[model samples]
Target: MMRRLLTLPLIGCLGACSLTPALQRPPAPVPASFPVASAVPASAPASAVPASALGWRAMFGDPRLQRLIDLALENNRDLRLATLNVQAARARSNIEGAASLPTVGLDATHSRERTLATDATSRELDRQTGVNVALSAFELDLFGRVRTLSEAAFARYLASEQGRDAAQIALVGAVADAYFTQRLADEQLRLSERTLTDWRQSLELARLLKQAEQNSSLDVAQAEGQVALAEADVEGRRRALAEADNALQLLVGSELPGDLPPAVSLERQPVIARLPAGLPADLLLTRPDLRQAEQMLVAANADVGAARAAFFPQISLTASFGYASASLGSLFDPAREVWRFAPQISQPLFQGGRLRAELRLAEVRKSEAVAQYERAIQVAFREVADALAGTATFDRQIEAQRRAVSATQRSLELSELRYRAGLDGRLDLLDAQRQLYASRQALLDLRRAEIANRVALYKALGGGLHADSDDAAAAPTESRG
Candidate 1:
């Protein structure tokens, strides 16, 4: 009677599982056009970026930089953590997939029992043994509950994979930024030391002239002050160089090579590549963070389906086959054999409104995910616009800084000659020297900013370090060709 009662609901649940509602994707709010002007110059042509290409090796031409990126990818702790996250997500997805299938197991048992006679017919001792192979406590996913859960898990796994790619891109950008900063610091340090040496020589000459009564004591004092200022600048630059070196080492996840190649000259201007003016919407499909957001939204949608499915009845099946006897030798006898099969179903008829509340909660989470997806799109658009604007402005700034540096250099030479000829005061020469140094530093800074902006642009366009199905399709053709 009890078995029949359990079986009724199981049949009903199986019937309900067949009727599934259509799953819907939350609507995305995409603008018709980017809000900012698309005025990138035609001088820079759009470079073709392959989806499967990753690492700084191909993007950055420098072999040393490629080595650094490789080291970072291997040893960086954050990247390792991201890798572990992907593994965890994959394992979770596997676990979820297993829930959709029936489970079967084999069992074997032997037992003995002894008891005092409690009644006239009671036995004094008992022994039993059994062996069985059957399905047990397997829940049938009649309402698509397991399927929905598995889908959510799969999306989460994809998100984890994208998260790893995001980390890799960020790591590459950081290494490049640090490398440029280090080079700039080295340049400043060299300039300071050279200036300091010149100041020392000038000071010695001033002292000699003063002793010969050819110049005043004030001239000697002024020369000493110049030497002190140059020395101070040298010390400051040295500290900056050390800091930059440490930062680069940290990014590479190791100490700088003992024979680390000489620092690249910051003065060498990199040719900025022109990217495509109007990118296709599909370009963003490869952006790791955007892909991650989309996956999360997909998972949330699946959760809603799973939660809704929970409102229906749940069904389970259990079966067992075994033998038992008072003596171990009789356990395998035909008369001792026994079998049982039980099917069960449960309905949440009343739970203080808990089921309704859970369904509402799932809906709320799904809504939140939709909002996040939209926000991610907005952020991505803004990043691209800002990078484009920066790239445009940086070109003008670089040209202007170059001109300023050249003019300052000429002014410094003229001022020094005037001072030696007594046509200009020592203060004038000092001012010109300060102006020249400032202009040179500013030019270095501008160049670094320009390169950094290019990096940002690449990141914004989702050009760096990505993998997708398109890449897979292209691989075979390329190999064959």
Candidate 2:
């Protein structure tokens, strides 16, 4: 009877596995094409290469930078935690998947009881013992209820994996950005030191001219103030560099090693890749956050099926077959064998509208997932567009800034010559010096912006093509400037 009862649900599971609704990906809500204003030096035609396809090694030409990124990947606590989360999600999915099979376990029971002699009656004792391999209340997935739940768990597992990928992408960008920032600060500090020396020389010259009645004390005071300001600027840049190092250290989960080389200055950082910003918005399909959202949506859809299945009957089976004996010597006797089987069916009649509400809640959750997925796509599109526009603008701005720096430099040299020959006052020389310094600073800032924008574009493009989950560790690297 137990074998017959268990067979019915198993057969039902085989046939009704398709009862859960089929999964269909929703259409993307973005435009058919990306609004790429201009590709970064897009001389080459748009290649179908994804940013994820472009490995980090290719993007960062500096060996030191590559090492730092590798360290972050290994030691960053957040990234490690994300990997652990993926493992946990896998475990949850396995648990759900196991629900479809019966839970077979060994169970043993023994009891001994005595009745004390009462009113001249002799004392008597009774003993009972049994051992069985039992199958507990195993649900029969006739309507795909447990199966739907299991499917949901698997989808969640996939989402978690994508989420970890998203975290990885963000971490890589952050490390690269901090590395660039530190290099810029180093260059800025050098500039400030050079300016301070020039200002000190000018102050001495002003004092000498005043002693000869050719310059006033005010000129010396102004020159001294300029020197003081330059010194302060150097300290400020020092603080910035220190903070950048701190940020990088935190990302690496330790202090940067002494043997690692520093990154090149802003103007010296290599352009390793010519990113194809002209890819269609559909390239967002490569974005991990968007993929994660879609998986969550898929999981929510499965939940709806599970909730819907709740209104119907649930069938479960419990069965045990083993030996029972009154005497220890006869424990395994065939004549003392015992067996039992039970099959239960539960159908909800009423529960204060609980079943209906659960179904509605699952449906609402599905809707929420849909909105989240759409929003992720929109945000990604916006970032790509901003990076594209910024890349073009920075090129022009940097070119113009270079010209301004050159012109200011010439003006400073001529002003110093004129002041020494008594053709101009110290104020004119001082003003020229300040102008040149400011222009050079502006040029450095523009160069920094240009480099930072390129990194942003790479990140916006989904961080290049990566190997599929199966062989991601062994994927070949590819990219070039």
Candidate 3:
């Protein structure tokens, strides 16, 4: 009897209809294509591989940076946490998935009871033993409530997976940016120290001229001031370099490996792979955060379905087959056979408007999710556009700054020669030296910005999610676990 009863529900499950509303993806809220107002460089030819397809190894090119990114991926606390969250979400989804199925258990029980002796009654005792297989309260999901909740959980799981990918992308960019900053500081410190040495030599020359009455004490004092300024800059650069190192170490999540490939200079770092800004729709497939937001929207939509299903009847079943006897030896005897089949149905008649309120809440949440999804798309669009503009503009800005540095270097040389020949005053020589130093610093800063811009563009376009462009397209969208 119990077997027949369970079979009926299984057949019902096969034909049960879902109450979930048909899902319609909200329209993209951005322009069809990225703006072309100086966002892309004319010289930059579109790469065969899109940014999403270009992996970190090929884009970074620097072996040292590549190693650091690998270490960060393995050990970074934030990434570790994101990965754990994905696992947790997967477990929750599995739990919900199991809810739509029956849970069965084997049961064994033995009980003994005795009536205490009394003046008018003789002592008596009873013992019973039994074994059975039981089915617990398993929902039939006739209205798809359990199934919709399971769907919601599965969507949330996918969202968490995407979130992990996003974290990884951001981590790679952070490590690269920190590495460039540290290298820039090193370069700046070197320049400051070398300038200090030159100014110290000039101060000696000024003292000699002063002793010979060829120049005033003011010349010596000015040279001393220049040397002091360079010394101060050197110290500041040293502190900045230390802090940058600390930041990089934190990102890597451990002390940098001693065997890390040789460091590349800021100027020598490879150009990040050029990215073609495809249509805004491509972001849906490429950007993990966008995917994550869409998944959340999916979960929210599923929640609405579940809320709707709740207004219908809920059916569940509890069935068991077993044996019962007074003696353990006879527990499984044919004569002791017993079976039970219990089916239940519930309908919400009146809840003081609670059910209606819940349905309204679910609908409102779904609406909110749509807005959030669209807003995420808008934000991602802005990020990609800004990165494109940076890539286009930084090159021209870097080239112009290089020219200024070159001109300032020549001016400093001439001013030094004129001052030594007594044709120009100490003030003119000092001014030229100051201009040269500032120009060089500006050039260094701009170079760092250009490299960092490339990193930003790579990150913004959803690069660094895979190690090879060839593998990115094949990356798994669904959790195998």
Clashes (backbone N, CA, C under 3 Å), per candidate, total 2, 12, 0
Better of 1 and 3 by lDDT: 3
Cα deviation of 180 in candidate 2 (Å)? 0.4
Least accurate stretch of 10 residues (summed lDDT) in model 2?
Answer: 472-481
Residue pairs in clash, model 1: 17-142, 127-326
Worst 10 residues of 3 by lDDT: 37-46
lDDT of 1 at 292: 82
Each model's lDDT comes to 0.74, 0.80, 0.87
What's model 2's lDDT at 251? Answer: 94
How many clashing residue pairs are found in candidate 2? 12
lDDT tens digits, residue span 84-104, model 1:
999999999999999888788
Candidate 3 local lDDT, 1-481, one digit each (tens): 9999999877687547777787787889998998784654556434678888887888888888888889999889999999999999999999999998899999999999987677647877889998999998888777788989999999999999999999999999999999999889999999999888888998999999899999999999999988888888999999999999999999999998789888888777775536777888888888899889889988998999899988988878999999999999988899999999999999999999998899899999999988999999999899888877787788788889989999998999999899879899999999999999999999899999878878887887888899887798787654222
Runs in model 2 deviating more than 4 A are: 1-24, 39-49, 117-120, 281-284, 464-481
Q: Candidate 3: misplaced stretches above 4 Å?
A: 1-15, 37-46, 116-122, 473-481
What TM-score does candidate 1 reach? 0.85
**Cα-based TM-score, every candidate:** 0.85, 0.90, 0.92
